[model samples]
Target: MKVVHVDYRINEKINVNQFYDLLVNSTLGERRPVDDVECLAGMLLNSNLTVSAWVEGKLVGLARSMTDFNYACYLSDLAVNRIYQNRGIGKQLQILTQAQLNKRCKLILISAPTANGYYDKIGFTNNPRCWVLERDSDISI
Candidate 1:
């Protein structure tokens, strides 16, 4: 097995451009709003918790989440640079994210289709009750 050296950071002040670049290099860019820098900035600003992995000061992996720090934590985005995948960087990011919350807090997330099996291997259970509301969707009375 190859050992990867990484530096993990929590709530580090990072620029949106770096995030955009990393996302663009990862599979996450496919589902993210990479064309909108404003949206990406908002996403980063609103997130209360973020665990990032850096290699030689370059952004490689990140786990962004929103939480109350006591009850529920929704991991909104988990992205690893394509060149740095399969080196446990993603798993470490999650672990660091979890460490910030209390034991009572539950970590939740909606996995990307291709990442479902990866989550399973990392000890996340499949929950089928998740629902999505698109921007164009309507709320019925």
Candidate 2:
């Protein structure tokens, strides 16, 4: 399959009704509502940190990251359609995102709780320098 990696600006024009559907079909059992895809896509678009893959004009894979453009980046979602799995689409998405990030940024990602091994194979090692704290999303700003 011929694949291309382009920035999320393309998402705006994609036939994403199915794109959203495929993401919701993730076998990892994470089924997000379509509304969540719309909201997340909007936020990522505005942040200038989303990239996606296309095959024959169809949205086949996607990944998004938040970056300071200088020092830090957090990769949020990395996905490839079920039909396209094992075809190297996911790796291509990561390569594209990393190429955009380069050496100037510290990259971090939280893999699906069950799919931790895949991320490790791609050169991500555990880092002790970071700690995460959770706050309710509804908490006051």
Candidate 3:
């Protein structure tokens, strides 16, 4: 399948609604309404570091990072359509997002139980030096 990779350069330029729609329709794990995705997209778009993927004007994937543009970054919401999996689109999204970060920045992402291997294949690894403090066992509120 042919894919179009794009880096959105301006805030408010992408349709947040479409972004949410694609994520929801793709059954990429969680389901989000248009407004929820819109809010998330709005925040990411205003952020200095953000990236997205499209296939002929259709939003198929998205990833965003919060960074100092130098030291460290937290990558969030990396998602690709179920139909588009295994086509290297996920890797391309990561590469595109990484290109916008500073070389000194350490990237981090929380992988789903089944998706860890995929991220590992793309050069993301578990940090031996990091620790997570859990305040609650219930993830769902």
Candidate 4:
């Protein structure tokens, strides 16, 4: 089989279909709202930082994040095509994402249940204090 060249780029604009495809092709699709195109579009349009891996011009992996470049970075999405998972593309994507952050900024992500072990193996410390308020939920305070 011929080898496809892989390239990594930062802050590249990836369209919704490409984003949806990559998400769905990876395990993340099960947890993401892939059927909602508008949501996916909004996600790509609103993210402040995005690191993507491409092979022969097709998006194969991505790291989408929102950060102020100073204190904290929320790594909202990290996905690699199932076919591309073991080749280090996902790790490289995270590395590129960190390269754009300020020295004091720390990357944070809520691990998908299936990916917890992978994150642990990659030097991520498990933090048990994360909390979330669903979009449809009301504030009680």
Pick out the ten consecutive residues of candidate 2 with the lowest summed lDDT.
Answer: 6-15
Show where candidate 3 strays beyond 4 Å. Answer: 1-12, 26-42, 128-141
Give the top-scoring candidate (TM-score): 1
lDDT of each prediction vs. the true structure?
Answer: 0.93, 0.65, 0.67, 0.92
Task: Tell me the tens digit of each residue's lDDT in model 1 across 12-90.
Answer: 9878998999899999999999999999999999999999999889999999999999999999999999999999899
Task: Compute the lDDT of residue 128 as modeled in candidate 3.
Answer: 62
Model 3 per-residue lDDT at 135:
65
Q: Where does candidate 2 stray beyond 4 Å?
A: 1-19, 28-38, 128-141
Would you give me the overall lDDT of model 3?
Answer: 0.67
- TM-score, candidate 2, is 0.72
Q: Residue by residue across 1-141, what tens digits does model 4's lDDT show?
A: 346678999999899999999999999999999999999999999999999999989999999999998999999999999888888888888888989998889999999887899998887899999999898998786
- lDDT tens readout by residue for model 3, 1-141: 655454333122456666666567654437344456556667556655657666667766777667786887777567777777777777877877777778877778777667878878998877666566676766775
Cα RMSD (angstroms) for every candidate in the order listed: 1.3, 4.2, 4.6, 1.4
How high is each candidate's TM-score?
A: 0.95, 0.72, 0.72, 0.95
Q: For residues 49-94, what per-residue lDDT tens digits would candidate 2 score against the true structure?
A: 6567766667667766778857887876777777777777677777
Give candidate 1's TM-score.
0.95
